[model samples]
Target: MGLVELAFSDWIGTITLNNPKKLNALSEELIKDFCDALEELKRQSVRVVILRAPAGSKIFSAGHDMRELPLDGRDPLTYTDPLRLAVRTIEYFPAPIIAMVEGSVWGGACELVLSCDIIIAAEDVTFAITPAKIGVPYNISGVQNLIITGGTHICKEMLFAAQPFPVKRLVDAEIVNRAVPIDQLETVAQTLAEQISKNSPLVISLLKEEIRLLSTSHNLSPETFERVQSMRRSVYDSDDYQEGIKAFFEKRPPIFKGK
Candidate 1:
């Protein structure tokens, strides 16, 4: 079976993590498939992407697959490395990406949502990060995305305590864009996406960049700047940038390939 279920309609691409029997945990194959799917969506000019879990399950994800983790005694970075790439793909995706959290999210699952541009959650959803409890360092790159997009204090408390925060707290902390009744979560995200898609994709990307630049410390120390620059250079030089410019002059919606 496909590790992820991808469907597109009305310019919206929906991706559901389908390993529900495993609580939708992220495995090497899942991460690879997810990244590949997002890359394909980037090529297809999909205006928006919604990430969700399978039906009859509220647990969006429980994080990494401990059983599948590499046990060759090699550096664990191998696993985290690929996962980080997946998270970055979500972060720099030109089009708007939304997290539709209809259930529980924990560990790397939380990290994934934190990467999205917006998060819409079910009212009763539980959001937690349990890395500390597992004795693993919460060193994901998306942690900064969480803190900057969410809140500094909120990030600190969550990381330090590694506990699940209620959906209401997630909304209050601004981690999630909004929290609605379970039945309304999808509607909320779709509404938000529809509103976003009406605007010029070129402008949306520029606005995202301008906001990200201001919100992020792009001018940190020289070393840090290099790191951030390295992380984002591909986006700057992507085909989407070229299409955006062409679309502006042509007075039409540009199809971005995310090259």
Candidate 2:
């Protein structure tokens, strides 16, 4: 059996972290499977995605594979190495992504959820980041994501406290979008994905790019701005734009070519 599983239907692709026996702690094979699944979703032009785990787990993920930690329990830089690319993939994926989380989410697991465009958690879910307690500095990318989702103060608390909090508090802090009953987590996540999938694909892709530019454009050099301008020009000249306008005039939904 694979560490991760992916399935698609009706323009929505779902990825499940399947190691429920280990609380779905991400492993080496899981990382590869996840990236491969994302690539497949891109190829299929999946309009939306929902990430979740199989039901009846005591936790969503307990963090890294602690058994692989050094005997002296040193914080291994390699532990976070895979996440750099995985988080980047999550951030730059063309369509919106959502995380459906129940039970406990810790360390890298929290970082994973933060990378998603939206997070819907079970009301009883617990969240934490344990790197600080383990003598590891939070990875810079993960810290940036925490800041983006929860702001500076909450980010500091999560890292400094090194303790888990109920998912509702996270929702209150805007770190998570929805907190539904445990049984309703999948329903809510799927409903949100369906809503996103119903949009114009061209607009969804363009807005994702535009927002990504806006998020990272701060403190950029003039050359960077110029490069961004080039990207903007390219988007304007895309064949999808022509199709979109044609569809508008013809009173029909546009079939975006992603060109």
Candidate 3:
């Protein structure tokens, strides 16, 4: 069976992550399937898209598949990376993509939710950015998404602490559009999608593009861009990066030393 399942009706296309056993880890193959699904939905002229998991799941996503991560000192999140591309696809998708989150979102998956046009989550939902926990250097664009959605202070707390932010906090920070009861999550998400689907697709598309452009409009000087890359490179090239991946596979806490 495929890792992603797609259903379309009433101009609303729903994409479900079907790999529950793996906690819907965003593997390369899964991400490719997701991207393809999005393209197909666009071709079909779906006015709205809802990205979700099966009902009653305890995890929306565990984030990137750790086993697929490169442990050989190579950058794991280059612009051409599958997960990065998938996030970009979500960001640039013509219609609104609603993330119907019912469980904890971690790692790159947290970035995925933030990339969506809107997020309607269960009251018990939580979000955590775990790059620090695994010594991964998050890219500038990803960091910008977090900052745009939750502000600089919230982004710093999540990245620095590598802890879960509860639904109340997420809503308070304006990261979640709506926080409903667990059982009402699907209802709320579906209702919103239906309402959005009834709107003018062209207007929504243009507005989404405008917002995407403005949100990501910041430019950096050549020297500053190089400096940012160097800072991220330092993390990925460090012994801490190696230790973090090792500890994850070894099921132990990594002891990171400033190198």
Q: Which candidate is the best by lDDT?
A: 3
Q: lDDT tens digits, residues 19-70, model 1?
A: 8778888887888889888888888888889998875576888887655533
Off by over 4 Å in 2: 67-75, 78-80, 219-259
- Model 2, backbone clash pairs (residues 3+ apart or across chains), number: 0
At residue 87, candidate 1 shows an lDDT of: 79
Candidate 3 runs further than 4 Å off? none
Error of 3 at 19 (Å): 0.7
Model with the higher lDDT, candidate 1 or 2: 2
lDDT, candidate 3, at 37: 95
TM-score of each: 0.79, 0.79, 0.98
Q: Give per-residue CA lDDT, model 3, range 41-62, as digits (tens).
A: 9999999999998898899999
Indicate the worst ten consecutive residues by lDDT in candidate 3: 68-77
lDDT of 3: 0.90
The local lDDT score (0 to 100) that residue 116 gets in candidate 2 is: 86
Give all candidates' CA lDDT scores: 0.74, 0.76, 0.90
Q: Report the number of the highest-TM-score candidate.
A: 3
Write one digit per residue (lDDT tens) for candidate 2, span 129-244. Answer: 87655434444456767887789998899898889978888888988898988878788888888989999988998998898778766464789756755654454455654554
How far in Å is the alpha carbon of 243 misplaced in model 2? 60
